[model samples]
Target: MRFNVWKRLELAAVTVGIAGVVLVGCAAPDEAGVSDARVAESFAAMYTQWLTEPDLTEMDRLVLDEAQRTGRVTQGQYQDAIDRLVSCMADAGYALQLTTYPSGVIEVQPPVAVPDGDDLMSSKHFCEKTTSIYAIMGYEMQQGNPELYADPAVVAFNCLEDADLLASTATVDDVKRFMYSSERDNFPFDSEDFGVKACFYGAGMAYGTVAEAE
Candidate 1:
């Protein structure tokens, strides 16, 4: 599972390194200030939300329980959950591939060459619930957002300001537009960009399993 949260997946649709097109960075000016406790509370609530998910399998409940007790999902726990998801999908006859890009993006390929719109998503969701994407997201969130930005969009806003990639007066909405609007190739969030590369270092992209994944 190449789900390195610091890389491009942080801004992706799932916000968990699942075929995302942007990266996470660090070094925010005072404006992005957010309390660590607030961030942790929001993140905890997010992790808790999954506990009530109807799609969760019995195994998912066990993972969530361990996470609750620990207050953090160890690298091993996160990877184990990913392994379970892959295995579960395979068991269901949907062969899945988790591909890690050199840019540290992780993509879970579709199970089949061509799939029915409804069936493919349904099957993927079923298998996905067996694993906890939150464990990985929590790691990245901790890294790229040590301040624990309760708002995911704000994380990138600070990164943008830190990098001076955009105008100094840019609003969070403007950054949001950059995130949802810009193409990865032309934007500074791309791995090839030096500014974000610096942010990667600040974000501490390496720790335990996350280091190995990258």
Candidate 2:
């Protein structure tokens, strides 16, 4: 019950934050010709892809092993729970979608110009928000449809959240910090470097969640 409530609240917060960011980002850019919608859209679209494609079998093994290690469940029941979850995702039609606000001109000026304004602050802010957003989405999706996920769905939820959030942000280092936080350190996954490879691979897998789980 605690996990259920926590998951729901986190999801609501994420959806609201993402919605607020979309509203704010729709304004005109500062000096750059880019649209805030562009950034927001890109982030949303990419993260959707990450949630859809995972080796549910392998992930099942990992979750059960960790649960065993953490004493949540035994090895024998892990596969059964995973099978139930995969079925749930398939049955639920769990597709990710992006909602948006309209366009408007905001401002064009140098940034707030903090001591380390150019890259560091920009990276951290975007990364932190992105991580929060996906964590929220992951919690929402799996929790809202608990019948669709395996036991210990939180484990997969965290994995998808970590990867999806990092992949959604603006830069590589920030993404790494978001993905490799202490909360996720024991999860046994690698940090994805940014660039076309990370973008396509990381984001590509998320979209694959729409397809039937293997």
Candidate 3:
């Protein structure tokens, strides 16, 4: 296996910082074209890029299409999340970075972890959002190969929890709307619909956290 050795190493490395599995994003099979080393490199590069180039508009453009394609979020919901996230970041004086992992997962690190920032993510609400997103990702990948990863329904549950947190501030209805919209947009990819759902669930969870904080 190309990633057998590297996978072990990456897991160990990540475990040292053990923020715990907060979000469960989709992960590809071990046979996915991208090698394990490639996955680690990609994750690191993406993380760095997100930190250096923190633009809300760019994030919206890049993530919205993917979210829509996978039924992760509706365009309107995406916009709302974006607005809410940006506002939260501005208010908290923090930034966000989305790091893609080879396990077909994407991990998010708070802005406070950056060179100069304060950590305001200790709130219970923030933790719920983080874990929910990861579960959502897990769910998305599970639909395709449930045994290969963690439970997909966990993603849904976490996303739901995160949405509840945001309900006090923003309209939680939009979260469901975005997910349905994402499902409608990705109608063609039937077999991979589960994967899409997982992805969207992650998106919803992540966005919900921002909305709640805002």
Candidate 4:
């Protein structure tokens, strides 16, 4: 089965910072096509871009807070863990770039905020919202060629995870609201009426599915 190498690598890149799987906002697959090498290069580029941003502080704090809440680390260790995450990303990015993967053009928009009045840190909320969005992409791909890809529902669930970070450097509440609103409004697919197929078509990915594009 042709695996959507880009999507898989995208999942790896975003979740690499955390201990578990995590999802960031969605991005349209590259029109130029995808390959394992390209995916690695794209991931490296994305990771590098993410690291350069100052907004990552909120994500760092969120990770630390969760660690403390779970008793995984003492307060004094928070900074250390945060430092480790950065180092990890740096190392991972470098490693991915070292591969002989080909390059592709994949455009990802910043996440749109969707106001669901849900808790920002709620795993359920993040999963449900992201799953809904990913499901659409999966469905569209399947419609084009079922044998080409795996189940969209399964991929969406496995690939996407809750993110406790935000961009504005604002209060957690403000950041949460902004993220939620962005996801709701700016989703590349039209989620209105929850039409997964329609949204996929709208994304202009209907001609080909994102299933492993080997």
Q: Pick the lDDT winner.
A: 1
- TM-scores for every candidate against the unseen true structure: 0.52, 0.18, 0.24, 0.18
Please list the C-alpha lDDT of all candidates, in the order they appear.
Answer: 0.49, 0.29, 0.33, 0.27
Best first by lDDT, ranked: 1, 3, 2, 4
For residues 79-177, write the lDDT of model 4, one tens digit per residue. Answer: 343234334434333111111101111222111232432432243323323222222222222232222212222222211111112223323233223
Where does the lowest 10-residue lDDT sum fall in candidate 2? 100-109
Candidate RMSDs in order: 9.5, 21.9, 18.9, 20.1
- Per candidate, the number of residue pairs that clash is 0, 11, 21, 15
Tens-digit per-residue lDDT, 1-214, candidate 1: 1322223423222433232212233434355453222233444444565466565556556766676655555656656766776777677677766644233333455533545656656766676555665555554454456455534446655665765765546566554443454333333344434454434333333111223335
Tell me the deviation in Å of residue 152 in model 4.
Answer: 9.9
Ranking by TM-score: 1, 3, 2, 4
Candidate 3 stretches greater than 4 Å from native: 1-73, 98-108, 112-118, 123-214
RMSD after Cα superposition, model 4? 20.1
In candidate 2, how many clashes are counted?
Answer: 11
Sliding window of 10 residues with minimal summed lDDT for model 4: 95-104
Candidate 4 ranges beyond 4 A from true positions: 1-46, 58-117, 120-214
* Best model per TM-score: 1
* Model 2 per-residue lDDT tens digits across residues 1-214: 0011101222222422432333323445335333222212333332343334332244443443343334333323433443343334334332212211111111111222235434433543343332223332332333232221111222233334444633343343333333233342323233332221222222211111112123
lDDT of 3 by residue, 130-172 (tens): 2232223222332322222233233333343443433343332
TM-score of 4: 0.18
The TM-score of predicted model 2 comes to 0.18
